[model samples]
Target: MNILQLSNRLGYPPKDGGAIGIYNYTKAYHDLGHDVTVLAMNTKKHFYSLSQLPDSYKSLAKINAINVDSSVSVLGALMNLFSTESYHISRFISKDYDEELKALLQNKEYDIVHLDGLHLSPYVETIRQHSKAKVAMRAHNVEYMIWERVAMNGSIWPKSAYLKLLAKRLKKYEAQRLNVYDMLVAITPEDSKIFKEDGCNIPVTVCPAGLDLDQYKVDKTKIESMSLFHLGALDWVPNQQGIKWFLSEVWPKVNSKFPELKFYIAGRNMPKNLLNMNLQNVEVVGEVESAIDFMNSKSIMLVPLLSGSGMRIKIIEGLALEKSIVTTSIGAEGINYEDGKNLLIANNPDEFVTQIERLIADREMVNDLGANARKLIENEYSNFKLVESLVEEYKKMIV
Candidate 1:
């Protein structure tokens, strides 16, 4: 089977959750002997030089990247305020990318044109027009839900109103094009249900972000038994919001309770405020060389996401690495986690403090949770196994 994967950003390094999803799926598809071609948008936010990528990775697909400046501007945001179009989706529309895609479609024959996320929805019609392939969209999140949650929790005045407006527009935009793709692959059954309730007429499959377990290896030697760490793309609004909320509401009490315990925050594009916060017992290691390495070294993984949709890829990786994790319900969305078994859930700051304290005191409980976490990933979220579901769906679509 020949498949073309259209990514919104760089996938090789898989810096963010979205990229990790794309990267894992693509690799799995390739390993399964599918002729996968990756045509990714090298956007300003996740720009990477193709030359920097290794031959081993390049061999997996006929890799191609087009420079797409999918950057938000003040004027564009203001213009969107008047228009009904979603500023979130509109930023990805690029003439350069479209032209390149047009040429690529004309040259190669693919059985499936896989859209990585909502960001690539704009190209569905173009793909339909140029090729005979069935279009399949991977919905990483209920796109509008993220903004709606952000707006609900927003503190600022005009910004909150503006966020609400964006959410409304995005919801409409999503609804209008529900049946555009031949099939919809949701990251969770919960998202699939929402799509069905919201009038998605296309075939929807519950396909969570599956991890390639080989990449995650737990080095028990490096594990810090008394430390806590949070790793994610810091540039993302939800991550920044989560970190801020954690510092203001959750961390203070926990720090006071356990003064010797250190909290390390690491990710790409660290916000200036977070980097310069100078919080005691907190190490702001902005960006690390490898996400898996950083995660392995930490004692407890913290995912304090207040508002974000989609499966937390890092959480899956952490689980695979046998790490004891504590995250809010929102942060733990899409993944099936037992509160006491696989990972601990803490919705509020107090709960977070309690969970952290619990883990710190009981080594046996931490080990039990970590082992259960690895078992969960092994049983359900293995990419080697999950890819078969997606492939079967694609085969059906093609037939």
Candidate 2:
């Protein structure tokens, strides 16, 4: 099968959930000997160019990444609303991208067109109406849910109101666009429920995210120092909020109990506020070369997420690396794990402190949980297992 995938960002570095999803799927399709072509946005506001395709990658399709014009930033999104429909559409739609896609579909025959993430949903209608291929939307998350979580978790009401309006528009558009695709591929059944609740009467498949277990392995050196690690894109509100809450409320208690234990925060775009936070035991390391490296070194990974959507890839990666994970009920959502078996569940600051204390004090318990978590990941979230399921879904869509 000839597969064409459109993504909003680069998937190689695996910086965030969306990138990780694209990278794994592309690798899977390529390994199956299917012709795969990728069109990634490279949303970072910088000039990016591609040369030779990776040896693992089959074919080099169109690469349309360009500097995000300041005129097309969030301010631009607002401005485009008042401008011509072309500009309004262009705000979210990349002109070069659309032209490249049209030419590709017109020139070559593709069995499947996998539009990755709702970021590319704007182009779904155009492809469906004009192209001759089976179209599917792999929604990373209901975008509105992210904004809604941010709004509810935010402390200030005025800021929340603005975000609330943005969420409203995005939610409405997300629901309306579901009809444009033949199938909606979600990372979890919970996401499918959201689509159905929103009146999207389309075929939905649960394609959970998987990790590269080979690339990530358990490091015994990581266990030498008792450390708690949190990793994700710090620019994300949920992560930022989680850290803020942890540092303010939870960290004090944890630090007082174990003054020597280290808490490492690592991710891209670390806010100055978080970086400058003068906590005794907290160290905010901004953007490590490899998150897996940090995870391997840590004794425990903390997922104190207050509000967010979708399956937390961080949790999957941590578990895959065999790290003892201490996460909130919300943080551990989507992953099927018994509270005391695979991972520790903590709801509030008190629970978080208690779990951390138990994990730090009891080596046997932490090892048990880590071993179980690793086994669960090997059995469930391995790339081989997930890709097989995804391929089956793709076959169903084409047939």
Best by lDDT: 1
**Residue lDDT tens for model 2, 1-399:** 888888766566556665687788887777677788787775553223455445444343434443333234667656645653333124447777777777777877888888887768778766875677888888777778877887888558777776676677777778778888888888777888988888888888887888878877688863556788888888778888888888889998998999898888898878898888788978888989877777777788898898887788989988888888888877777787899999999989999999998987898998899899999988888776787777787787778
Off by over 4 Å in 2: 45-48, 52-74, 77-91
- RMSD (CA, Å), candidate 1 to true, equals 1.0
Worst 10 residues of 2 by lDDT: 83-92
User: Over all chains combined, what TM-score does candidate 1 have?
Assistant: 0.98
After superposition, candidate 1 runs with Cα above 4 Å error: none
Best by TM-score: 1
Candidate 1 at residue 78, lDDT? Answer: 89
Clashes found in each candidate (C-alpha, N, C closer than 3 A): 0, 1
Candidate 2 collision pairs: 222-297
